[model samples]
Target chain A: MSPPLADLSAPPAIRPSLAARLAARSGALTGSTAGLALGHAQANLAVLPAVYAADFLRFCQANPKPCPLLGVSEVGAWTIPSLGDDLDLRSDIPGYRIWRDGELVAEVDDASAFWRDDLVAFAIGCSYSFEEGLIAEDIPIRHIEEDVRVPMYRTSIDCTPAGVFSGRMVVSMRPLRPPHAIRAVQISSRYPAVHGAPVHLGLPHLIGIADLARPDYGDPVTVKDDEIPVFWACGVTPQSVIASARPSFAITHKPGTMLVTDRRNSDYAVI
Target chain B: MSPPLADLSAPPAIRPSLAARLAARSGALTGSTAGLALGHAQANLAVLPAVYAADFLRFCQANPKPCPLLGVSEVGAWTIPSLGDDLDLRSDIPGYRIWRDGELVAEVDDASAFWRDDLVAFAIGCSYSFEEGLIAEDIPIRHIEEDVRVPMYRTSIDCTPAGVFSGRMVVSMRPLRPPHAIRAVQISSRYPAVHGAPVHLGLPHLIGIADLARPDYGDPVTVKDDEIPVFWACGVTPQSVIASARPSFAITHKPGTMLVTDRRNSDYAVI
Candidate 1:
């Protein structure tokens, strides 16, 4: 489980570097890194065999809103120096999900056991970057306020196809009053690498979301009468696409267990 | 009247400089400058007495979305050289609406007779700059396509008050399909000086706009069943505020007529 709001708000007395955090995670820090290295960029991870890397890259390029590609490692390389110095792709993340034929076969602390010379690591931008922006602007994030996960919905919108990777676009929802929603658009638009502005707002059914209370993934929080549900393109989209593609072997960071990088979230802001 | 779409699309064999256009207007060219000087920035003009200038500047600073101030000339000066070299404020624009105590007293071709030593000229960012951007991006602007004025509405949302200048925010509406609307947000966001992104979208009544067909100003264009109305903070807002404030004397560019500046529209794009 993620830490409470009070705990998340207070950083550790000693702020460790990204290299130090990854080394600690490799040793014993095996859990979600939700609020760790708060100002730095945290990335969603996907590792696949060299054969599927090209197709996946094209998929991300075509559907940038959902799969904002931050960095892609060279084939068989464990280090993506652009994202973090001295980082090991196989062991840097705190937790990993190992998949075979798109089925989750095991959850592990590190991926060294399944590491292969034919693997490629893909780093994707996450909404955590923009959520920090929203919070900085004092925009109320209901899920964080209520201590629940942001609701995720599988929308009617389709991701543009690229080879074997194709599926419906998935979105995360946050309920905000009209004024806050407008401000959210402005704030979020600055961070285009992290899903950018909203993909949809107000009318959910137009995007085929049947109920605000029943999300396809994550937990639903309160949507007050004064607030309208705002939706953003989600990182989970690539995970969903990977499942539908049914690759022979695949790996992803366990949800919320992101790769904490040396890059600050502000680095991704376009303006 | 503005020229037809075909004429507007075809640039004159020899494009005129800002000074040349002003000289033409000062002579016999007295009509809307819509679609003229295709690539250059065009601004809405507001001239007020020195007594009201300070409050008006504060009003613009407080309500930037609607009244994005581009350049404010020195008190009683006719030249805002930053906007255009040798540009005379009194006779540059093709048409002017002279107001006395908030009532439209005259529609003149030149403001030289009305110009006073106590008057201050304000050049405000206009939507025409961003409209060119949208058109370049292949997003069809309904008003421009139908060759009519863009619809404007007085919203329930109030402007942040500054001194004696206070009124409801006025917005300009455009109907775009969902995909085009999403792209519009991205394109418009790059030009913050010209209203930036939309203020409200989709549900019009949520902002107290009861009827889309009967706009408070400008001609209404078609809002198709597949389209959602996107609203942006409009330059007309200051005019509306001036009407309500009822200053002793004021001057504004007549509707659809703007002051063509030497600055390229591209210069205003942040990205």
Candidate 2:
């Protein structure tokens, strides 16, 4: 049987800058940014009122693998000039999930209407950057190969708590043969800002995942008989923590939709 | 109780250069170079007849975690200038263990007496470099604190085979609390030329180590109630493989007594 189509379309002639992309989004560009902006960094977004920002920053620092901080906007400011020339936190991301008292109130294209002067925006390093590295190395990503979302699970491993933010680590899984898995470890080790290497491999149940077919988050992909499941700490972790913490107000990028930044993925590579 | 004395001592005024140190050996150094040449790299030595050198090189390449190659000498050549000026493989190391058909035949200060025109020397990176890094980070090493050798064990994990060299990996263990273990992973990861990050952690039995108190090599240090055993692939693995390969002739540095080179440990740090 033919393999499923990957979102691997050729780059458009007018490669947009971070500002151009954000400007183009009349509302928010609510589509998956998987293969867009090939060489640039994409970020997971989290906006919280200034009151919870300090605790959230501490949370990211303590749980780096899951919530590697890329950039942080000042309270009452939507611009992170270091991340982009004129990035606007309210409308740059393709979509935003607005939460009130830990309950999802709405999924909106633009968060400008809901933005408060006391809000602080956190831009986090995303796994999509490392996936590019993996593809460049010719290691097959099962989900991309099958055209499905990478499988994610809520693991028994608990994140180090910081103030009111604490929850089980949510991990994304990919199945690969042992050799590829080893190579993946070496490649991923170069990008610590993007989750680094696998937290666990080979056994899923050991991390409390009962079934490979039933992931707690994204859709499951095929796991061949000869392959082992490799799990990486996912950026979804902060969202999970925010949910549990039941913050009075919180804003996050919708699943799979991220903020494209001017910074290149290579900027995050350590070696 | 006062902490046990570290091997730290003032460097002798002579402050011998790599060449001077080798010249002064008279025979081989025959003593642990642990606290000497504070910043220089120390290497584990392995010399084999030219007939088996190619296969051994391949083996090191395939299983880098256990045998990270720092330098390899040309057949019959005594020097690896990249590692140190005028390095004489046969006499630069403090001591050598001569093996004939897999059995250790003798321990000599120098292997110059057994040096053949067909012999090739390999210098493998040692853990001592990363130990310097760990110490610099203020991470307490239990064995170092207790003035005992680090414990080591043979694990069930097999090394990737190349030619006739194949065996279970030998690992050195350090017991540390969870927080320190996490920090160690981040620190050691910067020095891939050494063993790099740990191969296994937490549960010892999971890696086939039946008893933490009974080490296969080196003296077992205390494992505290809150600590977990962290294991790194050891340079001893190649020596173990040499024993099993039963090469017609082999020469290796005596355990703990390595060849000091001009390269600094910091030179191997990736970031």
Candidate 3:
């Protein structure tokens, strides 16, 4: 949905910060933004009409361990000053997924045509924030090091649903040795702005995740001999809920292509 | 080994403070002192002669993850002023295990006869400290509830050997759901003096343990379907190391048996 930013991505120049990244995203830069805006926070975008905004907010509050909320916008608002000044929710994310009546309509580079007065934008925390912390600690996150999207699974753990949002929880997996996993838990626990610490670790079957080699979303990475699969709540939970709610109109970030914001992960560390 | 504390395994007829507990332990009142002096520190006891004491102390220093040293008494001295006022190491513990050439020779209610001029007593932090914290937070420890010893295992993870003391790391197993396990990690991390956070969680096979149904030490507790096994470095590591060293003379607390002190668990809480 971003026009100006989308055009900037076509050039062979590097993108820096939200301003430059948004400039790239708005110009049809429908690509992954995993490491594009290094220092800024990357968010999972969810835009719904004002009619379901209150219910969705409550849903997030009720299921905080899985759906940690970062920021919300006013009705019909495309710009959320809290996240980033001049950042357009409709065009900031690299790619937008348009959902109509709870089904994927079409994936667009920008949401300019779908912008509605009643639509409210929401930014939820994602694993990408804490993943950066892990990397800085020299703790190897197998998925990131292997150049793959972290494997996301649909767990049997259900979210506390609101009026128009209800579904099973989604989790992202990162395989690490036990000690490394313990450190990851300790580090991630500090950032409640992110999905927080993992909802489950090991015992995939206990959480309704049947297969390690096959994931419901994203790419699967190798689980080394000394590693254990550590699972954290995924921002994709809200998307699954929206799909189940089947709203007549909705918008969200394309998986792995998030809305990079001015917020730093350390800003939310509790300890 | 603690005959004074072991004799009265039932709920204390009269609850005692740190001073009273020390008096009873020294007075040959052998009984199970699990909750005898609430809000005070209890320790793992390891008594060795000058020859093996150096090596054992080195073992603990090398593997601080398991054998966290609270205080070590001077050789031939049975009293340690730091852990407790007038704390006599020779007879303060209600029971003591007397070992000869690495073999448990006798289970004595007191160590009056076994106390050697070159013997050195060490006080290591015990899980009882963190377990008390968890219990205060309303977390249920099944073994304590079932009136059985905590199940422990000798894992394939080896300790960094020191002198003649070295062996596989021993871990205590506690079963908890993911959420409780996460909270436990946070709580335990505050008390690094007491082995700190768990060394491993879930995927027991990775640590060389194959069956949860059978334990190498202590009694097995129920493992719920939704629960994942949480493992922590145990105080038993010293006992295992001493077994490997096969010292001519060594004394330690029997499994589940401990030496109560005047130090409060809160005194050691880092945060």
List fnat, each candidate.
Answer: 0.20, 0.00, 0.56
1 against 3, candidate with superior lDDT: 1
**Highest TM-score against the true fold, candidate:** 3
For model 2, name the residue pairs that clash.
B28-B109, B29-B94, B30-B94
TM-score of each: 0.84, 0.67, 0.88
Which whole-number lDDT from 0 to 100 does residue B87 have in model 1?
83
Among all windows of 10 consecutive residues in model 2 chain B, the one with the lowest summed lDDT is B15-24
Residue-wise lDDT of candidate 3 within A90-176, one digit each (tens)? 777778999999999999888889999999988998788888889889999787788988899999988987887899999999998
All candidates: DockQ: 0.26, 0.10, 0.44
Worst 10 residues of 1 chain B by lDDT: B14-23
User: For residues B125-151, what per-residue lDDT tens digits would candidate 2 score against the true structure?
Assistant: 999999998899899999899988889
Candidate 3's C-alpha runs over 4 A off are A1-15, A26-28, A224-226, B1-20, B23-28, B51-55
Q: What is the C-alpha lDDT of each candidate?
A: 0.86, 0.85, 0.84
Error of 1 at A68 (Å): 3.1
Better of 1 and 2 by lDDT: 1
